[model samples]
Target: MKQFLRSGVVAATLAVAGVSGAGVALAETMNVTIVAGHPPVFRWVKHASQTFIPAVNKALEGSGTTIEWSEQYGGSLAKVGEELEAVEEGLAEIGLVSSLFDPAKLAPQNVTYFTPFVVSDSTLVSEWMDKLQSSNADMKAAWEANGLEYLGGAIGIDDYLLMTNFPVKSIADLEGRKIGAPGPAVNWLKGTGAVGVSGNLTTYYNEIKTGVYDGVIVFASAALPGKLHEVAPYITKVGFGAQYAGGFAANKDWFDGLDPAVQQALRDAAEADRIAYHADLDASVSKFLEIMTSQGATVTEVDEGFRAQWAAGMDNVAKVWAEKLDDAGVNGSAVLKDYMDTMRAAGAQPVRNWDQE
Candidate 1:
């Protein structure tokens, strides 16, 4: 579950004396290891191979540098939630780190999850996060402090939808039920009369089938593959908004040690990877929904009134979240307001304005 390899070393060997008395230049290759906690079932994982690795290779094609990729994914390098440590420890050179799972470590990156119902478009959410990470020093420092360099921007999971076995007509149906959510997402269920269990997509199916919990807050991309529809067939498009759960990052030591051109190549490839992943995910949403429905899943979109009820009913989690951050001297309040304003400026209309309220 841990590994490291120099990613794409540009080996230029000077002419060496041989028996023939002719010096030969030897080409050096950098062996770059890329890793992820989730398997290829997720679009991010898939693109890490299909889009990112190749893009990195392509970028270094004529730069006298070639990346020999050692792709270790699906928890082979790090299990779900352990990727950050793996990369930070230099166990792996690069990895897709799940910020959502590492709340204490990556709290600033979870801004979207704290302020829900802001935007539902995955690409837009990702683009905005990219902007924020670059424009805000704290955001970038979060990664640097952790000894990791965030590559490109950040990638996102699709808009979250409620998937459960019980019919979710309104907030009433969910009362007294145990619903699973990862990290801060549990707060979204506040005042909804449902107990939110700390859970991840990997365990949703088994957990739901065994009746460990009633339902889960999940997205179509994972729900279809996890086959959660079989156990939790009731799907609700509650507009929880997309999130920056995880994205590309490299160990600071490894990244800094690489040649500048190679580093730039990796960064460029990661950016291309961001674009490709969003496009693929956007294209797959409807298909996955159809597949799940065909497999007997029931789907519904909560009405505007219902959405407002749900959003308004929740405790002021955003304000509380900001206060906690501010008390820690982390500027959580400013981050919250800035995120809300950014989303609004981009024409987002949340069911409840998390910051203003």
Candidate 2:
């Protein structure tokens, strides 16, 4: 009886030890909140989270290192204007930021938006951005100074166009017209004689219907879902320049806290998400145009010469922006030149050089 009791005590101790060892070997799980100012319906934010979450989970599968998400869409967490600061302060681990909206924080890199007619293709633009990030340490340092790191980026809506209450066939038609444009887009209206009113996509539908503005500067992909077509049926393809590829940015401190393996997983997921998001966007552009036309929106193709004229008129905003950044003591001029040089090296031809007179 004594021998049997001693054996039972030894067995219990071994079981407890085994459980403790297993716990020690298991990796810790992390919860990351990814915030986007736009609604979930927008492809840039929606598809990124949808595709990225799964890829990350798969990468960490069976490793006991799980990433749970806190997805705040439709400006539920961070308002569109406050995204950069929100992520920097760790309110969100990741965010989808628009450089165009936060030029003060992003500076000369925002020149991409200021320089109209520089990039016509989204794919080439995206590739050029990747090259810029890799080659330009100064650009990365700019984001780092803001306590954020740009992992990768996805394209926003395609080239912007005018969706107005009235048809805009020529630049003369825009004289004194009250046009609603997102903040950075106001530069595109320079010299066009259009009265630029500040607005964002979230309020575009109601503002255009209720406000005194006659039309909005928006892209087809974004306009289709926002139902801007219903309010402004006259779709004018003004050949406005392509926008920068917006994407996943994270709090640098939070990112640095992760294990190296997890860091790589996040980056890989971001890259995959970017590719998938662009594919969906490319398809949606055609589909949205079709839907708008079917819904009685008058889609007019502006003359190619007129498009060139508009591009020429709005070309120098980049230089103006770069000088502003340089004046502020940021390395704005170098960053801008590097980005343009990268685009050129990749066989891209700018409609106009912002650095030139």
Candidate 1 lDDT over residue span 1-357, tens digit each: 223445433544444664442454335587767778888987788888898888888877766667677788888888888999988987778889899888888888888888888888989888888778767776788888898888863678899999988999879988999999988999999989999999997788889999999999999988898889999989999988888887889988888777788889888888898998898889999999999999898889888888888888888888988889889878888888888888899988888887876
Weakest ten-residue segment in model 1 by summed lDDT: 1-10
Q: In model 2, which regions exceed 4 Å deviation? A: 1-24
TM-score of 1: 0.93
Candidate 2 worst ten-residue window by lDDT: 1-10
Tens-digit lDDT track for model 2 on 24-70? 44455577778888888788877766888788888988776776677
Off by over 4 Å in 1: 1-26
> How many pairs collide in each candidate, listed in order?
7, 0
Best-matching candidate per lDDT: 1
Computed on alpha carbons, the lDDT of every model, listed in order, comes to 0.84, 0.76
Clashing pairs in 2: none
